[model samples]
Target: MARVKRCLGIDLGSHSVKLAEMALDGAGVRIIRMLAETLPVGPDATEEERNNATVNIIKGMMKKNRITTKHVVLCMPGQTVFVRRIRLPRATGSRLHQIILFEARQQIPFPLEKTIVEYQVFDTEKEREVEVLLVAMKRETNEEFMRLVRRIGLQPIGISITSLALFNGQDIQRINFKDISSKSGGGLSGLLGGKKTTKKKSKKDATGEGTSGEGVDAADQEVLADLGGVPAFEEVRAYVNIGARSTDVAVCKPGEGASVGFIRSIPLGGNHVTLAIQKACGLETFTQAETLKIEKTAVLSGSFEFEADKTLYDMDACQAATQICDKLISEVRRSLDYFISQPDGVGVDVVVLSGGSALLGYLAGYVEERIGVPVELSSALGNDQIKCATSYGDEFDYTSFKIAVGLAAQGLGIGRLSVDFLPADVRSMRDFSGQYVEFAALIGFIGAMVFFGSQIGAESEAKYKLTKEKCEGFTQKNTGGIERARLTALESKRSQIESKATVLSDFVTPRDYWLRFLSHVYQSKPARLLLTQVVCQPNYLGVTASGATTGGANSGAPGASSGTALPSSSDPRSGIVWIAGEAEQLNVINTFVSDLEQSKGASPNQRCVVKKATLFRYSSQAEKSEYFAPNPSIKFLIRVEVQDEEGCLLTRLDSQPFMEQTALPAAGAAGMMGGAENGGDPSAMGGDPFQEGRGGGRPRGGPGMGPGR
Candidate 1:
């Protein structure tokens, strides 16, 4: 928490929002905070409400935490997006995009206008010219998110498919969605040959790079945003995440060496089972049904054995699970067939099954028996190399956090792949059906930011290899060549720096690398902020002077506008307080002011971030301002105001005063760069970014920077 250099990732799931925060290090990505909060409107939510609710949740989170993040890498379920496998002769610049859009209309059931498109290309085979993975999602969904982000107080940088993060974390290449179980048997071991396994691969693109480019999935170029594990085989492997509502499968095939490949997502999820079970049991509540479904051995583990739960009294749990299992099998089979139908015909070596639904013991074996594909099982067992706490009771399961872990792993350049930030159009499920889907859109707005990064293990072997040249070129044992020894030591430092710097560069730009790290680092920390609204007006941005304790007229904390000459200097909270602006800008300004006024601050888990994004109402008696109304000319300029937790505006005078800067960020503070605590004060002279008010803020992660890079 020393500096304000933190990154955040969010997973807007069916039931809740899973968030992970990571701290970067010299070599890898590390976990800092983890949190999960429920999304209202119940389990069977609708897309409209779900979308709306999701946005509201995001806004609330950003507002509460005072997060002004712009580089947000979000995660979407693969099932929700469309994936198609096509054949191409070779890698081309924009040609692939053009072809995919045309093909997308044919492959995706929705009309062309309804969705946005993107694609990933893999290597070629005998019968198949080359394999290209086409991805698409609803266009409205994309716009909804962008608008919601603007509506709230933050920006949406990248929106990725959740499965990709998991795939990136698991280090999967082109998978035949069906072979997930084989991965559990030992697929990744081969890819991660050793600590020194980073010897570049031959996968190439039209650009001739060493093939690890994943920012935009290009032909021949491989993706690295998958769960990292000791390679199980030399061929190719897949990770199948059988989630509560959907299943995501990723395939990693090494052509020459380690790189990314085509990825696909489908809707075949656990909801099918839940629905079947609900019908069978005539269940009323999703909560009770979910509990009954997981605890009982019927549908999940693929085992017919019965547990000791008394709920199995009236109905036959085994039979219920059996019926649902039958249907589930068909769905999975279809997904697999769809994957196999690719021109390259995914030659999956092994399949590793993870996620909550995969908790079913021997499920991989069952899949293998049914599909003639080797299958293995893995869980919230952390990345293939590290481990996290298995703390949740039966009531709550952290096992569902695989995607988040994988995302952090990618975001941080920690575990495996570089499939980081993405457009919101990718879908993770085949069907997103539910009443909550409506409210879901609003409640799950927190879904937009996903963290995919990694934590670097202490690979002494890599260290040795890094300095081998230096060691060989030097003298030893207090001997003859002192200068040579000094040169060698310097070379060693240079080597380490070079190695780490490469990783650092990978984590920052090019998007995917950074999100991979986030998947691993961000988990359940509970420290989150929700931004309900944000106004990036003309004169409304900047940080002013303030102590740990705020004073003077309208003077809240650090990040606040100096104001357009307040009506009176006597206003107790002044020095530089914000008043409501005119029209939309005015409304937003007043909302903040009212929020500061209403009282009762944040709870222990949350805080507020009030920073000015712009400067509004700078009109003179002589000329008209840019944003000022044409005719009326902002007759009654609604100046910036402050609101409390309940959304009420605060007067220039309020004892409880919102000096509550602890859980919240100082208004207008950028990075950890203010004079405030961890970073600095938001309103210091040079620190007042809003004084000039170029942009609202940088990215909104947290109050302090993540680990050192």
Candidate 2:
């Protein structure tokens, strides 16, 4: 959205403070509202007292009117400001500004540094000169007004002189001028003109006769009285604003290459008129005089007509009104005549009356009559061309709102001539502060956006967590039964793999014991010994070397000194060891037996004894030749036994590390046969054949069978 600009014009005066708000719509300007409040104290009051009163009034007015805008322009009372028209040789803009400052130093009474100066330049097409309307005010006076505005929470955008503001007010109204011939009463044409002066030259002795009127004849009267060759529209015009305390006279000639021709302020105003009336009539209070001036007073009127209580003070009012009006008229005429006396001065054209006192009865007509010019009363509120907001009252005194409206017009960029006396440094600081506020608002907006974005993200994260938990719960409920079935299948597969591993381990382990026994035998035998056959059984008992006869028992093997009968060779549990080999000498056979008894391969608690050793000589040449013996050699059969610490036979299959400890006692042949008939394989008597066990040989039977046949 595009921003709309609103301008507020404030008029500070001795008697009252006025505010006028205006806004531009397209090309037209509309007056939003106007407010005015009388000062609580008089002119003799301190600045603090005046400012406090002014601040309170402004605050109440803004609140009551609901004024929201802060862009404001102030009107400096003409009395406090210095206005000058300085003409300079044709120069560039930069040079012109410097010339004006120099001019200010020479022309202005105040020090250059102590004043705030502003200017507007007008170019003359016919002359090589530029006229500058310079407006300057004391820095302290400007600051006082600025502080007053700021105390009411407003910073003015511009500070303008009251005369320019009054001119602006009249220009915006476009007041019409009446047509009048040069011969009109006292040469009172459209605008104010200088009084015609007549001179008669006395004839000397040579001529003896002289005309009474010497200068201009009747035919040249218009020419002599006319303002020097300038057009009526461009003719010098004056604005006489009769404020409460002083009257500001400003001359603005629009087209004659001049904006503000000149401006001056007279110390006489409505208050003076009222005081004069009070002194003449012997009024007890000034308030009654003011009331009389407003009600029964008529300036320059011979008879003052009272609307109320006519019998009491009619004559006195009449005398007072005439005397005050005569004095005011003399002052006004002198001011206008002085303006016209200047070089290249066209003098005041039309007089526009404003300010609160301009509303005094017959004051405008009396001034027009005395100064021989047309006087028009105008105010910001009363201007038909300017639209007023609905908030304004119809009875509003538009006269008092002139300066404020003019100030507003300046701020709205519609003034006829705009000049500001605000110091450059102060205006720059105000602009900077405005920019700072805008920047801060932008930062706050961005921060709010970021905060909201974070809040949205947090909400999304919480929703995601809730959704994830729900998914986990659903999976556990729907897939639990299938998971149990899967566990069972895995367990069964694990058992089969474990059984195969055990079988492999058992086969490898038994080889250690078998190799032990064979190594001992080989080490003990002489070099000529040759073994063709070997048998080992756990349950067998062999004949003892002591040659004592003992019972053969599968449960317990008798001592080596007590020979015992051996079990069948195929019964691995008989704990018997047999060997058949050929040797050339008997010593070799006896040495092998003795070494076997002492070998580490024997059972821990028993000795390996040569229970029987049979030697037979070779009966056939084939046998001898097969043995590879040239001399006679015998074939020997030897049987050895080993026992546990308790003299029980050491079973062959049970010799494995795994088989050493059992949950059930080892079964005999009858139990083994019975287990086979029931359901178990007879080969299973050795348990899992490949189970991890302590043994040194391969299985004695087929792949799936045990040692015993």
Candidate 3:
């Protein structure tokens, strides 16, 4: 599908503003609307007043016609804009632009900074130099014009000069010069049928010879050559757009794709003719002069006469209008002459007239006769390239809209000369507007990223909070179980300590029984006999009987011999205490054995009696005497049986109550017996007796009373 675009072409003329609403697509241009609104300000009005009036008129026209398009292309008045066709050395790209810029600065009369210059390059493939069409206008002039258009809320997309626009308005593809020539033949003859020429000129007249009696001048021959010699298709056409205040002229070579080769603007136009008529007839106002020129006045030509009943005022207006028209024609001819005199010039084969003032009576015929070239009025009525809506009636002046159509064509990218005089600021604004969709898409993408990112962040935060809460609850539940396990371990350790203490106590209690037995032995020793050694063995009967010394001899008793048996007991707790002594006489030996048999303990029922007595040897004088003095002594052995009725001799005793009762008594007895053994002085024992008993008491006899002695 082809994209469609609509634009309004606004021709801001000095006396009138014309608008054409054009719709363009792949097919071509379509005219949706056309309107012309005349400005009410007079020629003598101030520039500010004129601009104000033009803006109001344009606003009214758009409103009245219901033309709503704001995108418009404007054609600046030719007089206010500079147009030049320059030939330069062939170049392209930046090099060409630089050359054009240099040329613009040199060609444009105003300073380059204060001027807006635009240019278009013509097809120069066949030529050695580049042909460029340069158009420039003062910056202030262009800005002020654009400001007035903006006052009506219209956007000016492009700006062009009137002469170039007129050149663009010519549709070369649809323009058949043969048809135009045929149509022009009738119109010219019908308007100028009474005119006659005296001489018949031919090409030979250029060499001072002709087919007639009088030869034509060199200028007349040149005019005839231009009028008659060129083929219709190869003809070069000049477009003269006679506007209200200025006339714009454009010369184009049709052979070169209708490219404009020359352009000029003349100060004389339809308004000048109206003013001339006004001054000649002494009209009260410009309005009346304009009316008269439009209604009755026409330019005079050779042999052409007005109606006899034509009023004198009408005739005066015609002559006044003719003189101004002749001057305008002379200026147009001079422009054509200048264009022809150029090095690359071609004679203008035909002249086409357009604009509001081109509608004057006999103007075409008079210009054709004066310039000696065929003249045709330009129109868009039957152009196939531009479709016009029938809603704008047949009475519409299509010729006056040529510049507007050209502007619309330029906006549609269809003009031959595509130069635009849009200011730098306006071009930037248009470029920014063109990229609006891209900007919108960028903003939307950023918004989507932000929205999604925030959503993800919020969801992550929620999940983190949930996980944290679960972990805290699990920690709280495990704390109590840990404390209970720790307390159970402590209780088990305490039980182990108590059991160890009980085992230690059982080991300690049995030492008390030995202390009590030792006390009994010390008390039973006889005078003048020293007890040498005593050994008490626990679980002694559990040993073999051969190793026992339970039976021994008694020496001093009557009928006693070396060996004597004492009574024996079978108690397992009844251990043997072996006793040894040295006596001074034999009687003393027998007496010591008797006293040991009578030994008692802490309880009345506890007895430690001698079980056996023996006389081992008799010594005459004491051998190395320590215990026996230097008297005859006998050495004897006695074995005793100690009965532990209270069970104090048991190896393991856990009876805490019984152990406590015997503890103090056993200590005191051990102390007293230790003193008696040391010659009845308690100070002779070095340390505590209780400690000595626990550690195995010291030997009872003197040191020399050991077994060797």
Candidate 4:
């Protein structure tokens, strides 16, 4: 049997938590197990108790699995994060970054300093401009997550948005040939924040929506001709995932070539009923309320639902379900409106609903009339594909399990969309102007050396004449040895000056020193541009850069801050963020628990967030009180450990280097006090280490780290 790689998808919810794990094999993605753990939040349960109940569910899973995760993708709640679509200059280097930072500061709701921000470029036109989707979550939220995931021994590599999971059901890049296939609003997306432009459809855009098997013979002909492979019909159909609180609609339209369509959560969700049940019954113990609500209020109620024929929900339950149906109708209307707003507005042909809530017997009928779209129970992946997936027990709920199945199916090479969309080398710093200054300074020194050589030559000629005369005069006294010693000493001084010509003569530019630096720069691998203030700043060439090659034992993660002697610490958490979210605030309860589990030795997991903030209200003398509190916001900062894997703290030298590096500009420049102005070397670098490599790869204050590090 082939070893199957497991993909686990977890949905963090207020009332109930859902987990789905699947394994991928050659045939396809298989469903392994699906779980909907009862969330014990009750009307009267203490917040702390509710938090623990949520945390324990994940903890129990880890215990049963026996191994911590290697790579895990997590999601944030739909409510906590802010998402914005932005437009910036079509740039790829540092300028691109500068613009991104600038845009964030100007547009994001919170100050740029207070958020764990990451961005994705959804649409790119290398020459024109780029469209990016920026997401910012409270740093406290991320920190808590780090803590929790660590507790269970999993590396949470990428934190994706909840809405993104719906789109994962289709390979938008491969499946979307034109604007229509991309998404209903992809045409408008192209014009997002740009000039308004309407999409014009091509013949490919006219493709009618159909099942992946509708043109099975033609697909088979190509498949056999191309790879001698059979067509996968069962796996290629569309799926609609219904969640506890929302509905995700997507259709992997299929014909010979079909359109790909996706629409996000319908306002209608199972949580509506749960909330209704909670509100209507006023139950303190949700453990019991949840059962009553699901059994009585949900569509699968009566004998068809999970429980026995007993129904806990009554007339009030009918009201909740009716409201849910109403919400579904509104969402379906909006979804179709979105479709019509697209380049072609061609509707999807097939839709399969999946989610525990989908089991409601009357839901299809209720949703069908409103959606004006065909609906059916989701079918399992075909036999070959199923063989690739882990065998699930017959009791597994297909609806709740579809996310894990889809995420896992990504492993089977179905709808694998990268949560991380930025290119690896996108942030490269390419400005090499600093090197030109150095070369120019070296040339100036060389020119000065030439002048000195001329002077020395003149002195030598005079000395030669004097020496001959002295030889003549001293012939009788035999005093030539002292004269020769003096001449040799003068020669040695010139040699010493020549040796320092490159560095000592820095900043004195000659015409065209750029060509000189460029000559050697091509050969310097990993060479970086640092402090390239090329515009008339004397210090531009007077740039004192410190860098080093890799040496000693190095861990493969980002080292520390490059003690470039910056007066500021990039880490928002260097001290306390005087805002609402405090250093002590636990935003993500489960994550905090995980971090607590991962905490080793003396260090507790640390997070940087704004504790409090205000609208910058300025007042007179007595207005400000000593007891005033700041609402700290969230920001990005990484965790530092005294230890490495296998429970070893980093070497003292290693940790100390970063600390000093992080602290240098604060401590070092504080003492320098205009040293550069008073004949101090602007190029006089602190003998710190980060000067070794380029970018954030090397640690702070290390010899190899470049300026950006």
* C-alpha RMSD between model 1 and the true structure: 30.4
Whole-model lDDT values for every prediction = 0.45, 0.58, 0.63, 0.42
CA error at residue 227 for candidate 2, angstroms: 25
Ranking by lDDT: 3, 2, 1, 4
RMSD of 4: 29.1
- Residue pairs of candidate 3 with colliding backbone atoms: 552-613, 553-563, 553-564, 553-613, 553-614, 597-610
The residue-by-residue lDDT of candidate 4 on 279-382, one tens digit each, is: 67776654655676556664432233444343544656656666766766576667656655654345655556767777754676556656666667653432
> What are the models' TM-scores?
0.45, 0.51, 0.56, 0.43
Residue 635, model 2: Cα distance from true site in angstroms: 99
After superposition, the stretches of candidate 1 with alpha carbons farther than 4 Å from their true spots are: 1-6, 46-71, 91-115, 121-131, 148-154, 172-205, 208-235, 257-268, 300-315, 337-343, 346-349, 360-369, 372-374, 380-398, 413-709
Which one wins on lDDT?
A: 3
**Candidate rank order under TM-score:** 3, 2, 1, 4
The window of 10 residues in a row where model 4 has the poorest summed lDDT is 532-541
- The residue-level lDDT of candidate 1 at 206 comes to 47
User: In each prediction, how many residue pairs overlap at the backbone (N, C-alpha, C within less than 3 A)?
Assistant: 257, 24, 6, 60
Point out the higher-scoring one by lDDT: 3 or 4: 3
